[model samples]
Target: MSVLDCGCGPGTITQGIAQIVAPGKVIGCDLEPGMVERAAALAEGANLDNLSFQVGNILDLPFEDNTFDAVLSCAVTEHLGEPVKAMSELGRVVKRGGVVGITRTDWAAHMIAPSCGAVNRFFELFESGFNLQGGTMNGGRNLPSMLGEAGLNVVDVLIALSGAYTPEPGNAMVNGWAEWIENLPLFDRVIEEGLTTRDELDAMCAEMREWGAQPGTIAATGGCRVVARKD
Candidate 1:
């Protein structure tokens, strides 16, 4: 079956999808030009003939209606400036029986205690941007409602829970919080906005690392997998 990867980044996932769907077509699209280029390189490196990467905004997908059999997005929906518009576009492009999936970090669930004062401020500001962009920290929280409103049926709702380990002085929960903040694209932005400082970020991460030394610190990704069928 054909597949579309919305908000695909660096084609790491695109290349994986290409491998999974050998002899079938797989297209990856992203809003960032840098990401599109990176995806193209990865796809080409893998020699994935069925894979293609494009740069396009989700709010206004540059594809015709009923053009895909399935669409998947990861760590992206929450970053969209217009998730509703983006969701509407996702629903509009796929044919009946086609499936759609979205995965994003659950910001609401992210906790960072014992952090540097600056990093704490940054975390708060960064989380706020999820709303500023018209999305949310927990993209899956309202998946059913959002998809239903967009004229799609909730075919399935799968929840995936995962844990990471730092194996040191830090505990899983503590390291998890540190990792989340360090991994955010908004961290720098927030810092620039005077929400926090680099020293704070480093201190927090160091503390987490120290705290995670035993058997490794761990972070659990309590994510939701939503399957929606086009009407």
Candidate 2:
């Protein structure tokens, strides 16, 4: 089957799908040229003939109508500036009876830690800015309706992958933040507001790690995995 993996970042899911498809083809498409290039390089390095990469956005895809047998998108809808139109675009490109699989992560708690009143306030301010200036951040709840409006026949709506997603501090997750915290823009953001001192933030980060490791303290996010067919 010819599958189109929309917003396929760094070939994470695309690489897995490529293994399953084997000789069949999968196209990993993303708006970021760098991501497309990296995905292409990874596929080539692995010598996987089933996978390829394209720099494109779902809001205005480069492919012809009825081209792909299945269209798959994950963790991408919330980033779009116009998700409703993007859903319609997905339907407009796929063939009749083609499947559209979707996955999401509604991570509100992650955006702001549940405890730490100061940290909570800090995250609220940070996220509020994103919400105000950023184009769109609608989770999957809004997408099912958008899919219906897009004229795709709803086949099944189910959970994609629902389980614990707590990021253990000092693990890969904390290091990721540690690396990103230096980003002048985000660093300046927290400091400008005087939300929390760097040392306190560091301690809070340690607390996040501790809480994430403890059983039952880490909360998992629920996501919707929708299966729709083009009529």
Computed on alpha carbons, the lDDT of every model, listed in order, comes to 0.73, 0.69
lDDT of 2 at 224: 74
lDDT of 1 by residue, 86-172 (tens): 778988888887988776566455433333453344446667656655666666677667778878888888766655544445566
| Position 172, candidate 2: lDDT | 41
lDDT over C-alpha atoms for residue 35 of model 2:
92
> Which candidate should be chosen as best, given TM-score against the real structure?
1
TM-score for candidate 1, residues paired by index = 0.81
For residue 143, give model 2's deviation from the true position in Å.
2.2
TM-scores for all candidates: the values are 0.81, 0.77
